[model samples]
Target: MMQTVQKRRTAGFLLVISGASLWGIGGTVSQYIFEIHHLPVEWLVAVRLLLSGLLLLTISLMLGNKEKVTGIWKQKKSAGAVVIFGLFGMLAVQYTYMASIESGNAAVATLLQYLAPVFILAYLLAVRHTYWNMRDAGAVLMGLAGTFLLLTNGELAGLSVPTEAVVWGLLSGVALAFYTLYAGPLLAAWGSMNVIGWAMTVGGAAVSFLHAPWNAAWGSWTWSMAGSVIFVVIFGTMIAFWFYLESLKYLKPQETSILGCLEPLAAILASVWWLHVPFGLYQSVGTCLILGMVIYLSLPQKQRAKPAPA
Candidate 1:
């Protein structure tokens, strides 16, 4: 039994890592679209969300999963939560993150977004009234310290970051935290595909309404743009998220969260290689520390009581 559990845990960690890696690719891809194509951030976001949502919806329908949507509206509370997740969590986070990236460097924006774990810990403690252990507290401190290092390029004294970028980055973290926290319960009630698909649909609708995608310059659409959109929808959103949900069945939430730390690192590397973004020595050191903390905090604690003989 113990061996089986360990194997499952290992598999889950791998899946989560894979998902993080795909997500990391998005930063570089989005940067390419933004810089090379000179596309407006809002318009890009609007198109990505709209197309991704439609693709997800089509898949769900083909799989005959209409029950997930129908049952969602029947339960008022769940429906409300889904709406909130779509609006405040998905939509808001994506917008803030895009804005942050546009206003500042990708590395800076990514480092700030990684603060989501801190927000998650705080939300668990305050809102859920969950007690924190020494491990949790240590992890939070380490993460924050690591974030400071990564953002300030190891020299905390010579930091000269912009205020607006910082604000947007922080907002992105908060929104992501809400999304992660809300996801577990919602997924438990409605499967991952359903929750993600519906949330994307609603969030896409919201963004479209806000940005008015119809007024954008759709005339400049090229094969590269279409390819990026296809990749984001299929690999980034659908397949990656599906893997993530499967991994959840095998690992504990904390364990999965710890593996998710790979996301920022992946993003950093992608930015460095694909976008030619340089990472200072300080940032490298800070990122290593943060990744270490995530792994430590995610380890399972041994029970005080001895196990009974088989």
Candidate 2:
């Protein structure tokens, strides 16, 4: 039994790292597609959501979640929640991250999005869901200092990244906070696969009307572009999400979330090495601080680690 449990834990660790790293690489590939091939961000978003959603739903069926696959739509409140999550939460997160990448490098974009936990903590305090504590305050301060340094290179003269990129990156962080909190109830109700599948499908369908995924004429359609898009949709979206949800079954939420730092690190490395994006000393320190905030927040307080429902 002990050996079995140990093996599961190992699997969970590997899964989290793999999933997060894939997401980081996906962002870089998306940047390449956008910058080099001039693909429309909206088109990519719409198609990615739609295709990934369908694939997830199919996986749910294969896993004997047939009941959950169809049960979500039968209720009024859940149905409503799914739709709202799809649009405002999932879609918002996806769109803003892509927009930030288009406006700036993937490293900065991803590190900024890691500010989600900071936003989540702030929201908890604002709503009186969590009480003020010194540790929480410290984490908040760390995140702020990191952001300041990252944006202005530790000097208040100006921003190292574009203003538009910063705006979209910050928005992505906010959307991620919303996504995490809003997803709790849905995951509790219908399982992660079911909830995510439906949310992505709904979000994708909504985006399709606005962006029209069928139109690829706006961008240069090369074999590389096609391959990049396929990679983003398949391995990045579907496999990454699957690994995340599966890891939850074997590891505590805190463990998986802390390990998620791998995502941004992968993005930073890929950006600098592959894309030749700048990463100066100040920015490096700032990256460490932001990542430290994520690690600190993931640590257990007075309470024990909570198991994620998924």
Candidate 3:
């Protein structure tokens, strides 16, 4: 039994790492599609959401679990939170990330977006008033401070960054935090598939409106565009998310999230290899610090014991 448990945990860790790596590659891949294909950010995101959501929905139907849709809708309150999470968390984050990249560099945007875990820890402790011991608090602070060091080029004073890009990146962090927290309760009641499907559907619809897909130049679809779309749909969105959900089955949420800290590092590597972007020394140090904090945060808390009778 212990061996089986260990094997499951190891598999879960691998799944989470794989998922994070895929997600990391997304920025570089999307940037390539946009630049090479001359596609609009809104249009690209719209297509991604529509295609990915449809594929997941089809898979769910094939599995004879179409009932999750109606079941999710029946719980109107729960559905609302799911919508918020998918819209602001998923859709909005995508938008902000694209905007940040366009307005600044992928490196900066990626680092800023990774601050999501910090925001999540803070929200849990400060707003929700959750019981976070000293270690947890310290972990959060270290992670956030490291992220700051990474983004600001290791400068503690007088940082001159683009305001618009910073705003978008910060917004992405907030959305990510909200999604993580909100998904927990909603998933507990509605299950991951139902909640994720509904959330994706609603979020996709909202993005469709923003992009006005009907007005897009569909004639621009070439072999390259088709290939890019297929890659994004299959590997980036579908497979990555599947791995993420699977990992959760065997790993604790914090443990999985800590492993997710690899995402930015993966993104940096992808950017360098695929896009020929340079990774700065400051960013590398910051990435290590962020990873350290994640590990710290993921450590299991020591439990107080009851006294035994003599």
Candidate 4:
């Protein structure tokens, strides 16, 4: 039994890492589509959410608890919660992150969005009345230092990217924090697929007007662009979400959050390699510091660690 449990935990960790890595690659691909193919941000977001949502929902119907899918709207509170999550959590995170990527490169956008942990920490302090500790302080300081170095490139003044990119990236962080906090109760009540699938559908429907994907210039679709779009929808959106959520069964929420930092690392590498995004020494140092914080926080607490055999 112990061996079986350990195996499941290891598998879950790998699954979470794979999901995060895929998401990072997808972000870089999205940037490519935006810069080279000139794909409109709104249309990409719309199609990704809509198509991915449908695929997930179909899978849920096929394999998951069909009762959850059908009875999702039976309860007024759950129905309302799903709508709110879809509109504020899903829509905001997706749109703001994409906007940041459009305004800047995937590296900067993803790194900036990684500040979600800081925001979440602050929220816990305020709402949950949690006590401030050395760990929290260290994490906040590292996050601030990382953002400063990444944005200014160690310059005395001004940002490396446009002011708009900074704003969008910061907004993406806020949206991510909101999504993380908001989805907890919902996930506990409904399974990952059911909740995420419905949330995506709601968010997509809400944003359908802006993109108007039906009226998009389909004539511009090339083989490369089509491949990128399909990969983003399938691997990035659907598989990524599914794997990450499945990991929650074998790992604590905090552990999964730490593992999710893999996304930023992958994004930064992909942007530097593929997009030729200029990454400075200061940015590299900042990335290391932020990653250090992630590792520190992810360490098992003394009380939680098991004793070795005597």
What's each prediction's TM-score? 0.84, 0.95, 0.85, 0.92
Model 1's alpha-carbon lDDT is 0.76
**Which candidate gets the maximum TM-score versus the true structure?**
2
Model 2 whole-model lDDT (C-alpha atoms) = 0.91
> In lDDT terms, which candidate is top?
2
Sequence-dependent TM-score of model 3: 0.85
How many pairs of residues collide in each model?
0, 0, 0, 0
User: Model 3: how far is 30 from its true place, Å?
Assistant: 1.0
Candidates ranked by lDDT? 2, 4, 1, 3
TM-score of 2: 0.95
The better candidate by TM-score, 1 or 2, is: 2
Q: How many backbone clashes does candidate 4 have?
A: 0
lDDT of 2 by residue, 124-221 (tens): 87876777778988999999999988888876789999999999999999999999999899999899988898888998898888789987684546
Cα lDDT computed for each candidate against the true fold: 0.76, 0.91, 0.74, 0.87
Question: Which of the two, 2 or 3, has more TM-score?
Answer: 2
lDDT of 4 by residue, 1-310 (tens): 9999999999999999999999999999999999999988888888899888888889989895889987879999999999999999998999999999999989888888888878888987786446567877988899899888888889977788878888999999999899988898988888889999999988888888897768677887899999999998899888999899889989887889789989989999998998899999998888877777666767765442323437
Instruction: Identify the runs in model 1 with alpha carbons over 4 angstroms from their true place.
Output: 1-15, 156-162, 250-255, 302-310
Model 1, span 203-298: residue lDDT tens: 878877667667666688899987876676677666666677678888877767777777677778888887887788877888777777767756
After superposition, which runs of candidate 3 have C-alpha atoms over 4 Å from their true positions?
A: 1-7, 131-133, 155-162, 303-310
Task: Judging by TM-score, tell me the better candidate of 2 and 4.
Answer: 2
How far does residue 196 in candidate 3 sit from its true spot (Å)?
A: 1.4
lDDT of 4: 0.87
